[model samples]
Target: MSSLNIATRALTTNMAALQVIGHNIANVNTEGYSRQTVQLQNAGYQSTGGGYFGKGVEIATVDRAYNAHLTREARITASTAAGDAARLERLEQLEALFPMGDKGLGSALNDMLNAWADLSASPSNSTARSVVISRADAFAARLRDTAGQIDLLRNSTQQQVGEHVDAINRLATELAGVNRSIIETAGGSHVPNDLFDQRDKLLADLSQYAQISVVPGEGGSANVFLGGSQPLVLGTQTGKLAVQRDPLDTSRINVMFTQGALATPLDANTLGSGALAGTLRFLNDDLSAIQNQVGRIALATSSLINQQHQLGVDLAGNMGGNFFVPTGPAQGLPAPTNASAATAAATVSNPQALIASDYELRVEATGFSVRRLSDGTTTALATLPAEIDGLSFSIGAGPAAVGDSFRIRPYEGAARNLQVAIAAPSSLAVASPVLVTPGTGNSAGMSVESLYARAPSANLTDPVTLTFNADGTFSATGLGPGNPPPDNPGPPASYNYTPGQPLQFNGWSLTLRGTPTAGDSFAIGAAPSSAIAQNAGNANGMLALRSLATFEGTALSDGYVSLFSDVGSRVQNAQFSAAFSSNVATTAEQARANVAGVNLDEEAARLLQFQQAYQASAKFLQIAQSTFDSLLQTVGR
Candidate 1:
């Protein structure tokens, strides 16, 4: 190569370098733009049968200043960090809506328990009863509100899914256009570095919406598939994606391909670790679970409260009314009609009338014969039998006239798979009564005193005892042998089977019956006589509050107060955990951005270096041109 030709090659190389440097400076602030540099090589000098050397530099190629491994790492980092942030933000919103402490369900449940206790303390106070109703109402309201908030989140997530789908489609279309341009520009030895950067940015965006697998295409484009199936993009032809409402949940959106008639449900379980995954999880899993937990709390609380309230004595000294009703499953609402309530009352008079009206009376003849259930002995009686083991029967003193019926159930072997039916519609015959001689001996055929004497020996400090005092009053304590004496000891008494009067105990009535003797003890029986005993002494309020607050009381004391504390603690803990997760995610995302963010200062420095090198090369080319021109002129002379 001659000096003039070498100078020409050097000038072209310097000019190309300058152009590359200028392009980098122009796109320094542009998103996803990678810097470029011009590579140079020495042009060889030719000599006839002599050593050859390079005269001047020639432009080899314009290359992108990017490391493939580092670029991939950056993309993966952005995808995961963005996904985490999105999930945490949604969870935080739900957590905030389900407030903890006194303001939340915990406090309302506590108020309900206290209301019950107040009602029990003053049974005649209608105000107390009203408070109970109000507190229960508050509990229900709070639960419903919390559920509504969760639903709102679900609906919002659906909208987000739609927006994300739109974003993904747009990015995919742009990527395809970039692919076409790159393939066309790369027809010869030249490569479009700027277009490659744009393509990388779109791929990073794609990863946020779905767990994508990228395949290198014929040109610079990538073939993208989601979750190992379903093509998201195909070279220069991008696949269309859309969001549709989920059939099962209108508040949620499902992902689908535009070409396909079939739809795929997009849920948290299906799409993992991306923006769509986070939103889907919030809708189908996180929000739904919280709502379910709230529902359970509401259901359990209502059921227990209603049950115990019915069993206890009310202000009028009558059995209290139902407080809460189970709104799910077993007792979902309007109580099932009882057989007794469905039948008409009997209308007969006198001894013969009792027998004649038996056919018309709605008598549930259980057909249970008397048996020493402990020993399995059967004996017939005019009255309904009480000593049967698995059999229970009730009789109507047959006063039935017309439009009356009887139901009968006979005990089967061990189990009571007995059947019942209306035996009569108008009247029916009553069984003949058998008379027996009265005796001074115990009617139970066993000493009644023995029943009271056999209290449990365990927990001796609380010795169980029975007391009978003047004016026919009575008392019993749940104490053992070593327990302390009764606090108000002088009350071994009975009721006036009381004329124009009612017995009172702890601000409530105690209606007693029959006579009592010092040594001739009438048994109080194993069961308590209090109306509250209808609840089986289980203290239903504790259960009510526990369920209301979603509090498990494995470590709590056996009382309503313990239940309240446990529920409050759990709610507070959940709120704290949610807040902490959100804060941590936010911090981590910021850190990730700092590490991978585009830096204008660094890009500028690169620009200046490449520019200066290009300028120096141009000057060298000019100096070589002048020297070559002088030599040529001298040779011509």
Candidate 2:
């Protein structure tokens, strides 16, 4: 190679090195920018006819000082971690509104139950009734507050989504600008590394708002998808996304693209590792569910206590006062028919409208009676004893009557301390007076209670005489008390093995095979026995007030408290899990960033090296100049 060629090669090599150093320094503070380096090699070979070689320094290529594998790993780690962290942050914010343990919904529910129990222990105490009402209202208020908080969070997320949409569009515009610059400057075999870096930065920023996939396109460009196969940006053009209310729930916002309202389904999984996904999960999944559960508890508690308070007689013997006014949404009541007055009496066209699963009614006439509406069964109550059946039957003053009318209420078995027990007789004969046996077994001792519980049969034509002597012994003689021979003609008789279980007690049952004479006397036992007692339905047509009872405050029934506690536990666990996952992902992302991060000190060293190389090339040119000058002078002499 000639000296001119060598000098030109040397100058070009120095220039290339200088260009790389300048580029690196210019982009020192730019995000996503990688330091560049110049690759040098011998110039293209020129072969003489006989295997000779001539060469000059060649500028091979300019490449970025980046580890592609490490960069890719870092991106994946950072993207996933960012998504999780964003989601967890949103959840934590929501959870702050509803704390766990006794101070939260669980405690409120427990307080309401305790109040009810106290009222049951002292049914006539005005203070106890007031306490119950107050506590019930507290529970409802908590629910209302929780629901409000959820709404607030949901609305906030929607606002953020709107702002994010605007941001994404702006980012798209910026990226498009970068794309134009890159295409103009270095679109072909060589792309401007800095401009490409700017574009990549925009892409990474846009992904934080939504889930995106990118595909390389012609002209060193890319097509971006918002979700699944929905295109948001194609080459130089960008798609628009708008925030709109969800059709089903106006409180929520949905993201939709311009063409045919295309949208990426916003869910925890789809928005997998981005801020938008986190906000969506918090609003739709976590906060919404908490609101629903709390609302249910409130509606149930408020409706139940209010209904019971209406039915129960207060200390002043007043009925139908406000016990616990619900603070949540107003409960829809079934419109009353012309024939009925009570809430239950109103015909319900839609069962879904029923807010509470409990019902109660207390009727006090010659005796007191309590009923539960949930299962439509009456419980024969004996609070203060009253004279009945030639013996004293106890019943409480129960609740006061509003005029001649009585109110029926549904009881929440899980929320109160009251329990039910059915009483029935064990024998079949009427020789003994009715006895109180604690109702037990399936269907509350169906056998003994069925006689009265079921409608009486009208088949027996003959009048059966029950002879109760002053002694305990009792007998059934002729229809008119005229004693006849054992073989005299009479109606057929039957016998009952158990009192509540009906056997044809007419003479036919006594003589299943043999017919009983009309005047014949049959001995039931050496002593008096009793027939099965049935739960007499309330005077009203509906059996919706039979499962209620009064009990002490210390023993509350399994009701709203348990349900509330369960809800709190679920929320706590979900929040904890999300936070844990977010933390782990964040840690991993930080580690990856540390490994691939650019160091200013290292770039500074490379700058000095390139500068020194340029100076050395300049010195070589100076030596060649001085040698040429000296050779000219020597040749002239």
State each model's C-alpha RMSD to the native: 17.3, 16.1
RMSD of 2: 16.1
lDDT at residue 570 of model 2 (Cα atoms): 53
How many residue pairs collide in each prediction? 28, 50
C-alpha lDDT of candidate 1 relative to the true structure: 0.49
* Candidate lDDT (C-alpha), each: 0.49, 0.47
Q: Which 10-residue span in candidate 2 carries the lowest summed lDDT?
A: 421-430
For 1-637, candidate 2 gives per-residue lDDT tens digits of: 2555666677778778777777767766666776677788877667778785656677877876555455544555556555556656666676577665666766776675655444333433446545644665666566656666666677777787678678878887777677666657653666566666666667677766766777766555657776566677776777777777654344456766675545554434655556666666666555554454444444344444444333322222222333344332121122222123422221222212333322233434554443333245555554533321111222123343432222222221121222111011111011111122322221321222211111112322244543222221224543322223333122333221223222334311221112222233322211111221121111110111122221111112333344445455655765676567557656654554455345667667876886787677677777777788888899999
Error of 2 at 183 (Å): 3.0
Q: What C-alpha lDDT, on a 0 to 100 scale, does residue 51 get in candidate 2? A: 81
lDDT of each residue in 1-637, candidate 1, tens digit only? 2655665776677677767767766776677677677787877666656677557778888887666666665555555555555666677676676555678666776676666555434433446545655665676666666656666677777788788788888888888888887777765776777678788888878877766777888666678877446677787886777777644234446677664565454444545556876666666555544543454344444444444344433322344444543232110011122333332211111111111000111223443233332224445535442322222334443342322233221111001111111122111101001111122432332222101111113241232233444544445544224433444544432223232233322211222334544322322223323332222121223332343322343211122243334334544654564456456545654454454444567656766775676676667667877887888899999
Q: Which stretches of candidate 2 lie over 4 Å from their true place?
A: 1-12, 22-29, 44-58, 66-77, 100-102, 117-129, 186-189, 260-272, 315-322, 325-605, 634-637
